[model samples]
Target chain A: METSVLKSKLQSYRELALKGINHYVPKSEPRKHLYDLVMDYPSRGGKGFRPGLCISTCKAWGGNEETAINSATALELFHNAFLVHDDIEDGSEFRRNKPTMHEYNNIGIAINVGDAMNVLSIKPLMMNINILGPELTWQIFSEIEHMVRQSVEGQAMELGWRKENSKCLTEDDYLRMILKKTCWYTTIHPIRIGAIIGSKGKVNPDMFNRFGFFMGTAFQIQDDVLNLIADEKAYGKEIGGDILEGKRTLMLIDLIQKLKGSNKSKLINYLANCRNENQLDNASWVLDKMHEHGCIEYARKVSKHMAGAALKEFYTCFQNVEDSEDKDMIEALIMHMISRDY
Target chain B: METSVLKSKLQSYRELALKGINHYVPKSEPRKHLYDLVMDYPSRGGKGFRPGLCISTCKAWGGNEETAINSATALELFHNAFLVHDDIEDGSEFRRNKPTMHEYNNIGIAINVGDAMNVLSIKPLMMNINILGPELTWQIFSEIEHMVRQSVEGQAMELGWRKENSKCLTEDDYLRMILKKTCWYTTIHPIRIGAIIGSKGKVNPDMFNRFGFFMGTAFQIQDDVLNLIADEKAYGKEIGGDILEGKRTLMLIDLIQKLKGSNKSKLINYLANCRNENQLDNASWVLDKMHEHGCIEYARKVSKHMAGAALKEFYTCFQNVEDSEDKDMIEALIMHMISRDY
Candidate 1:
């Protein structure tokens, strides 16, 4: 399929998921401030990738929109809630081109807003009891349970690395961290959950594991790449912000491994001193070293390899399924995730 | 029941619930930091009032310890998680005489810990599926759903009042706020959840509504009074902490109503300026004013009246049930709650 066609198809799914989230997220009185902050992220909007993937996989597996919308919305709510906390933890200034929740509000209120959204997210999963019945609800709930644990574990790993200024990290270490942090919530659980809803609890959730891992890892590497290269407007966040936050990105790891002599100590000194956005000036030096070391090209090649592997795993997992536009979109998403500019 | 015996009875129930919580709260690696911070609040030791009421009421109505333990742990986990966030939100320093979670750790990590605990709390509640089965799990889930919403709504009310610095609050406004904030989770839902578990989904949850409201309100008033009058060692938190935080306690409301001229403006100035523990010196003046207006005395009268009503409602609800030690403990708890110094 052509790239634009696949892109349009994914955008439609994003729209559908947004509508479901809009319906599910509470907007009433009292703690309306909390709910309002929750809506802030989704309303400003990202790619809506999590819920889009969830709903698409559900539909591709023979479920209709109605059957999967609640769970899809739940996934999106959890994703946004994580972003709210992540921005605070990373000390990033912006998300989706606007002030992050903690920047717009105080850190205290921002934490409450994230906490409230986490609580509100549970509401939609409980709705599964009515839509899909107790047994399937448990399955979906268990998937979410595992997803949240893995994501937080991943987040903790990244935070711990930054906190200690650990310099001994390897590329393999980065992979393991993102696998827990990004892959599970980003691809694995969404696919697993969609299949559970689509198959009415009959799907082997384990089958999607390899496919999700490859695709989500590819997506993340591309994301890190874009953080360095993409225009700030196109990226919808501060360009080179990851370096400023001293994140253990693939490029950073590769740059550290490939550099020698004065470069190594300079990078270490830069990382040790740069705890927040104030060090953006030093960020470009790190970025230049990453580019000089072929870090960007290396990451791209690895992401492309992962995307190719994902396509193979996609076929193995979806071979028995019937053909549908949703199936096509899911397959095409692998290519889009790797090749997109934003 | 003598006060000592009643206290011992409640203590036993508290121990049972604590055992369940200790078993359920996650203690594994990777996210251990998050879970460790979670155990911080519960381990420092609260009165265990919520879980004690839950387990005892469940047993009194014919539920076994096995049937009620999970829900009881869940209530406690939720309560502790709330404390973690509430401390951050209210800028509170001491909890159970130790630094607040955000005070003990950085704000970012503390928020993550609270988020992780919120997620961990759900795991035990889901265990209800195995122990209590699907139908009743849904009932318990629904009860929790309402409890979380009410608690957040109530918290929002308190936070919003402080944010706006609105002095137009009446005693009725205070009651309405506490009804959502204090009464529902602390008293009403615990009893309602206990009855549901005991009756195996057969009991009417509403019968405990009035009983819980009066009991919880009285307990809160006593708690407020103890905050002022108890020894700092016995109080387990900073004395006069609530005044410094500008909490809209019943006593504060009463003091505001009774004061005239400069006294009113002075109290308002203290509230407007002192948002945190740094203003402890100013806190004593507000506390002194509360005494001068007979505010603490007035709050105690209202508390005694509420406790008397709670005892009456207790008889109306529990009279039909067969007598047991659990029932006796529930009966005696009213006296203990109203009369205790801490």
Candidate 2:
């Protein structure tokens, strides 16, 4: 698919998902503290990767857009909910080039708003019962259950790593963390849910797991890369945020492994600065080291390899399914993940 | 219906529900930051009124204890999750005679733990598919969905009221807030859920709403009263903590209404200190004013009347059901809510 075509397709999916999200958020009183804030993150114009992936996969597997809209919207809401909490967890100041929900509001209101978003997400799934029937609705619920658990478990792993500041982390650990944290909800489950809904629960969702894992890991690595290199206007978040937060990206792990003696200790001390003092200088130093040690280049190569594998797995998973624009969109999305400048 | 009998029944039900909660909490890696903290609030030994109400109501409606256990456990987990976040929102220092989760750990860890708890609560509901079947399982999910929404809405109302510092609040506002916040989830839904399961979704759950609302409001008022007067050891929380948080309790509103001139301004100024300065002196002054202005007495009377109405509504709601220990336990539980010193 042409890049313009892909962008338009993503825009359409995001619009549909946003409509579904707005329908669920109550417009009653207490708007300022809760409901309005619940809509804030969704309205901030996310790429809608989750909803797009879900809807396209559903269509690819023969389901109509209506059958998938509610679940797609739920995925978008869940994504926003996670981002709200993740921002607070990471003490991130910006989201989508705007102040984070917690930063704009107080922690108390932000926490409550995130919670309200979570509660609101359930409405879409419950509505699925009427459209999809109880059996299929229950299946969707089960899919969401696993998605949420995996996401939180992944979050727990990442948070634990940051808290302990474990320097001796491995590539396998990074992969495992991303698989649980980013892959399941972000890519794997969206596809699984869409396919299940489209195929009427006949498709073996496990077939998409490997494809999603490879694609999601690559997507996450690319996201980290963009955080370091993308233009401030295009990235929609503060550059080098991962470094200041001491996020354990692949580049950070590789850089840690490469440094020796005083250099290694300096990197360790920078990582240990949990209070985030002198963040600009420290982040710049770490970013420079990542370049000098070829960490960023190494991450890019790994991401490319993963994307290549995802393409292979994608073909394997979708071989029997009939071809359509939706299928093409999925392939293009994978390519976009690695190839996009922003 | 003896108080001691009710105590023992509550104890048994609490133990059963805690076992279920423990079963659902993952015992995997990332123990310190997530799972262990997920278990912390439950392990602090809550009164388990929610689970008790749910289980007994189910049995009273002819449901087996085994059938109601999972839903009851889910309710308990949700209650703990709310408490975790509530403590953070309220800036509470202590709970169950110990430091709040956010106080013991950090905000990020506490928030994530609460999120994890919320995620874990879904497992029991999903497990309901086998025991209750998909149709009934979906009903339970719907019930939980509404319970969560109502609770959050109610929380939003309270949080908004505090944020605006509205001094001209009314009794009606208090009732509406409690109805959404405390009554639905704490009392109403548990009874509705249990009755639904016991009767196999045949009973009209709405019939119990009034009973639940009245009982829940009364329970909340009594809880507020206890926050001022209950023994430090018996209450398991710091006395007058609500005053320090500037919570817009009924007593505070009543005291505001009665005070004149500088006294009224003084009280307003005291409540306006969102930063909680001079907490000890301010909380003490507010408590004394509540006593002098008959605020606590007025609240007590309102609570008693509500409890009396709950008793009447209880008979009307449960009139046709057969009498059993479970039925008696529920009646005793209502009485216990108003009459208990603790």
Candidate 3:
């Protein structure tokens, strides 16, 4: 598809996804307060990648857009739920370079607002039982629940390591944390949910699940790379934001292993007592060190490999369906996500 | 009805609720540290009335005690969820007059622990679906959802009043706040849940709802009174704690209404800035003035009336029931709650 056509389709889906969300919050005084609090954080802007992937991946498997949007709305809600709590956890005051919900609203009301959003995330599915049916509702709810647990588990693992002052961290550990925490929860659950519910629960679920896992991993690695090296103005989140927060991303871990002497000690100390003024400088130094050691190239290679592996998996399972359209859509989306210029 | 027998039941239920709660946490290495953060917060010492009401009310409606215990455990977990966030909001350093979960553990990990407990609250019901089934699970989940909404509403109302510099709060306004924020969510929901879920969810839900409402109001009033005049050592929480926090309990509202002159100004100013240690003496002096205004007696009367009304509601529906054993047990439990022998 042409860029303009693809962009327009994505725009339409964004409107549909927002509409799906607006209907659930209802126009009550109290409900509106909650709606504003939640949507404020996530809707400032989006590449709309999560919801788009949800729609396209479903279309890849011969699913329609409408069914995909409900799951997509949930994708957006779950994504923002992570945003709300993660912002609070990381103490990042900014999202889209604007003050985060908790920091702007103050933590108490923000906490309640987040709690309400989480519960409200399920409300749409509950109310849509007539449209979605109880069985599909249960499946979607279960998928969302499983994703939350995995993300939280991944976070806990990272926090545990961060607290214990342990530097025995490895690339394997970093990958596992990112995969469990970010990968599938963001990608697979949304895709699998779209596929499963769009199929009206007729899909075997396992194929979508496998497809989501590989794609989601690819999606997460790209995100880590972008945080280190993307144009901050376009991304709207700071390029070195993760380093400022001492996040245990692949780039940081890889750089640590490859750097030597005072460079390594400086990076370690900067991470340990990280303050705002020094964070970006430290992040830049670490990035340069990683490049010097070829770790940046190595990280890029890993990201491509993950995306390629997922594309290979998609082809191995469904490429020979005798319909070129479905295969073309899958391959196009995979290519676009993996190679898109942000 | 004897003290020893009541003690045994409370003790037994507490033991079982703990065991069941431990089982729900699920031993995953990554998440165990987070679980430990929740487990260590004043563990093994809730009075268990919330859970007890769940099971007890269920039993009163002709259901088994085990399901009551399960429902009770669920309520306990959910309440802890509210407390964790509330503590952070209120800057509460202590719970049960000891270090609160967040203060004992850092806020980040404690936030996750509380969320896990909240999530775990519903998991036990899923496990109990074999005994209670899907319909009942839906009912319990719905009831829990409603309580969460009301609690948010209540919190909003209190924060609204606190932000208002005007000193024109009525007893009615205070009562409404407590009803939604503290009473219904804390006491009534658990009571009704225990009762309804007890009859295996086939009980006279209407009767239990009213019973829980009255009892919940009574419980809040008693808590208000206890906050003012209860024995510091025996009560296990500091006296005049509500007044110090500038919380709009019935006792403080009554005193604020009836007072005039320097005392009124003192109370108002103390409330506006009572958050500091330097304000403690003035805050205590204001509490003393509240005692002089008979605010304490007024609060105590309101509490007794609510409890009496709750008992009347329980009695009116079940007076003609055929089971003498259940009738006696119900009578015994209600007495123990209202009585202040210590």
Question: Which candidate ranks first by lDDT, i.e. highest?
Answer: 2
Q: Candidate 2: deviation at residue B39, Å? A: 1.4
Model 3 chain A: weakest 10-residue lDDT segment is A319-328
Collision count for each candidate, in order: 0, 0, 5
- What would the per-residue lDDT of candidate 1 be over residues B1-342, giving only the tens digit for each residue? 787777776677667767777887666767445656667787887787888899989998999888988898888888888888888887778888788877867666777777776777778889898889888888888888888877777777777788777788998988888888889999999999999999888889999999999999999899989988888887787877788778899999888888889988888888888864367777888888888889999999999999999999999999899999889888888878888887
Candidate 2 regions exceeding 4 Å error are B276-278
Residue B303's C-alpha lDDT in candidate 1? 93
lDDT of 1 by residue, A179-246 (tens): 99999999999999999999998899999999999999999999999998998897999888888889
Task: Give the worst 10-residue stretch by lDDT in candidate 2 chain B.
Answer: B274-283
TM-score (chain B) for candidate 1 is: 0.96
List CA RMSD, all candidates. Answer: 2.2, 1.4, 3.1
Using lDDT, rank the candidates from best to worst.
2, 1, 3
Tens-place lDDT digits, model 3, residues B78-107? 777778878776666656767776676666
Query: Which runs in model 1 stand beyond 4 Å of their true positions?
Result: A260-262, B276-278
Q: Cα lDDT for residue B172, model 3? A: 82
Per-residue accuracy of model 3 over A215-235 as CA lDDT, tens digit each: 776777677777778787666
- Residue-wise C-alpha lDDT for candidate 2, range A1-342, written one tens digit per residue: 998999899989999999999998887877877888888899989787899999999999999899999999999999999999999999999898899987877888888888888888999998998899877887888899889988888898888889888899999999999999999999999999999999998998899999999999999999999999999888889998999999999999999999999999999998899455866887899999999989999999999999999999999999998999999999999989988877
lDDT of 2 at A227: 91
What TM-score would candidate 2 get against the native? 0.98
